[model samples]
Target: MSSLRQALSGAGAVLLAVHPTLAQTAETSAPTNASAPPPLLWFLISMLVLVLLVFWLILVALLAWMRPQLRQIYDLPTVHDTWSGRVLGLLVGDARLVKGEVRDELLDHDYDGIHEFDNDLPPWWKYGFVLTAIFAGCYLTYYHVLQNGQLQGAEYAAEMQQAALMVSTTSDDPNQLTTYTALTAPAELSSGKSLFATNCAPCHGANAEGKVGPNLTDEFWLHGGEVNHVYKTIKFGVNGKGMVAWKGKLSGKQILQVSSYILSLQGTKPANAKPPQGEKEAPAKTLAAR
Candidate 1:
């Protein structure tokens, strides 16, 4: 223990001697004064705040000045002109307090045989009926003489012409080169399947087994069986046939993909096909075969 104490004393003296050198270094190197933050930072923040405050003040003043103008534009009534129900509940009453637009449909309920047609609809309410009648007159004038095609088959013919113009699939030889585009990718097939689920599944089953529309998987086709022919049948429906035109319901690309999928169903027959109604058979495409 005496030897350890002697060693500690020697270490303490060494440390004590080093402490003066450290103190001198600290005295020489320690910052006497720190630099103030850049005035530009404070200046930018102060300017931003001042600009915001000025903008706020300007906005408040603009709103205050425009208040009367806004009120005039909206036709807000002055205090004197504003409605305050009838004096002494006589000529002017709570019944009159009802808005000018608010009309009551008073049923024929009379107490003690005293019938009263007390207050009819306000002028504003009556004007709505008048406006409706006036519009009806204009409607008749515009539709009957000016554009009578809406009814009586003229409009129907015009509409058909418009549709025929839209389908631009023309041919050099009607016998060959059917204009329908074929869908080959899995992406196209998936999209067609989704579309069939949404549109045709309710009619035709999801797998094209017969439901409301005919089975597409069967070799037998009501209209025709080829991809292009199927596209045609889909685009412009067979006349007097349960199958309606799907041109508007499905886009051209969607129709092509669906037709391609249906063609892929060729040579495979489902359990039920409606006895092949149409005489036409699709031109064979070996590529479309499974």
Candidate 2:
């Protein structure tokens, strides 16, 4: 004991001597003053954990309370060792017992000679109601009073804003090639052909030689023949010319693919070609400027 005391005293003296040196070194070095997040964040985390723990405890207690009843059910001759019977037992406990309990629940007062039973609500229903109340209270506190989360309207607006940003970024990409400059792969052309067959064939004819609409398989175009011009014409459409705007029906990529397909069809002679409806071809820049 004396040796241990002497050793502790020596250690304490060494610590005291080293303390000043350590403090001086620390002061000379960079001061690490990093702080943790706000206490409210930790408080919310703790509350969530507490709520989960409480729910767990409640579930365990409910299961423990129901054990005896379950055992009784399992012991019944009809339900013994049968999965279906066990399920039925859990869903709707012994009808005979329920009927007997209902008799005891009879209320003395009668209205219009009709006796009312003061039976308690089913356990499953009551528990569900209690859980709903708890959920509502928590939702109100977190989303409204404390302002910890966004409401539905705010969340939707935020998502819409994010979507618009994504669209703007994609549209503004300097190196992003349009279908006219980029498309050529066999698969991409095939996709465009399929889209054209499905959407554009009805009015322009299956081979795009003209039916109710102008011939697509020719150099002459009612709208300008430039890729961007064709793209805009398809997107906006001629208001009184019976061509409905396709932009709302098709995505931008789909529109580009279909436009590229139309470009591919130019200069081919058709059996029954429609007469040219617009002015003779002009330069791409001039057409776009219009």
Tens-digit lDDT track for model 2 on 1-290? 99999999999999999999999987766444333445668989999999999999998788778878776777789776465554545544544322322445668798998888887665566678899999999999999899999989999999987776666435333223334452556777688889999989999987888889988876667776777768777777788999888878988778777877777776667678777777667433223322
State every prediction's TM-score relative to the real structure.
0.36, 0.36
Off by over 4 Å in 2: 1-182, 282-290
| lDDT of model number 1 | 0.66
RMSD of each: 17.5, 18.7
Candidate 1 stretches greater than 4 Å from native? 1-178, 280-283, 287-290
Q: Report, for every candidate in turn, its global Cα lDDT versus the true structure.
A: 0.66, 0.73
**Model 1 residue pairs with clashes:** 86-92, 203-212
List model 1 lDDT by residue over 99-157, tens digit each: 44234445588888866554556645777889999998888888886874376587788
Residue pairs with colliding backbones in model 2 are none
User: In model 2, what is the error at residue 204, expressed in angstroms?
Assistant: 0.3
Model 2 steric clash total: 0
